[model samples]
Target: MGGLEGEGPDRLLRSMVVADSRRGQGIGTRMLAALERYACGHKVLALHLLTNSAADLFSAHGYSRLDRCAAPDSISQTAQFSTLCGSSAIYLCKTLSVGD
Candidate 1:
């Protein structure tokens, strides 16, 4: 499962999870794709995520690692960045071509 935190152009991708039993089946990839489609439909220009793990999964899907401080306030102000995820968590982003 996965979710986005805001409706604005810059949004946070959070709460992504796949049960241990569901690993290695491409479910996470499918879920990410769906979320991207949903975000694009809502006019989101970029997606930001903090992951201590799964960076490879995201990177493979076009997300690039970035400095946490580089995140826009719209995403930096979210609880995911302020409190939930730690400083050590890897920050990644994907710029989407809306309506594509």
Candidate 2:
């Protein structure tokens, strides 16, 4: 999908997953595309995620690693930031653009 002209729905994308049995069949990619499509419809400019897993996957898919302590307040103050995800968890972000 593409990016919207204004503000989008949610800024944070939490806990993306694929069952172990379905790990490498392009399902995750498709799912992510669908989610991005919806996000674009809502005009979300950038999306953020916190995870201890899938570093390479996220990186290859255009997400950039961010310092947990240096994350923006919008990201750092989330429940996943303070409680759900661990203190050492990796914070990553993908900036969405038109036609992206």
Candidate 3:
């Protein structure tokens, strides 16, 4: 799932879960790639996402961990930050160029 910024300028990617049976088949990677494509198409400047323990997966796809205290205001107010994910959840951001 994902949330788009006002008029879709930025996007917050959330919760990418492939069934355990489907793990290792590149489904999660494909989903994230699609979101990246969408964000680039919309001219988004950056994409943010919070993950509890999936840092490796995100890192592989170019996301970098952000210091929790320095998280963007928009990410701080997300439902994943406020409730769903734990306080120790890792915040990650990826800058996206308009093309490629």
Instruction: Give the number of the best model, judged by lDDT.
Output: 1
Query: TM-score: which candidate is best?
Result: 1
lDDT of every predicted structure (CA atoms): 0.92, 0.73, 0.76
> In angstroms, how far off is 31's CA in candidate 2?
1.0
TM-score-superior candidate, 1 or 3:
1
For model 3 the local lDDT of residue 82 reads 72
Cα lDDT tens digits for candidate 1, 1-100: 8899886799999889999999999999989999999999999999999999899999999999999889999888888899988899999999999674
TM per candidate: 0.96, 0.83, 0.85
lDDT string, candidate 3, 29-87, tens digits? 88888888887888888888778768899999888998866666666676766788787
Lowest summed lDDT across 10 adjacent residues in model 3 is found at: 1-10
Give the better candidate number (1 or 2) by TM-score: 1
Winner by lDDT between candidate 3 and candidate 1: 1
Q: Which ten residues in a row have the lowest lDDT in candidate 1?
A: 1-10
Q: Could you give me the TM-score of model 3 versus the true structure? A: 0.85
Off by over 4 Å in 3: 1-8
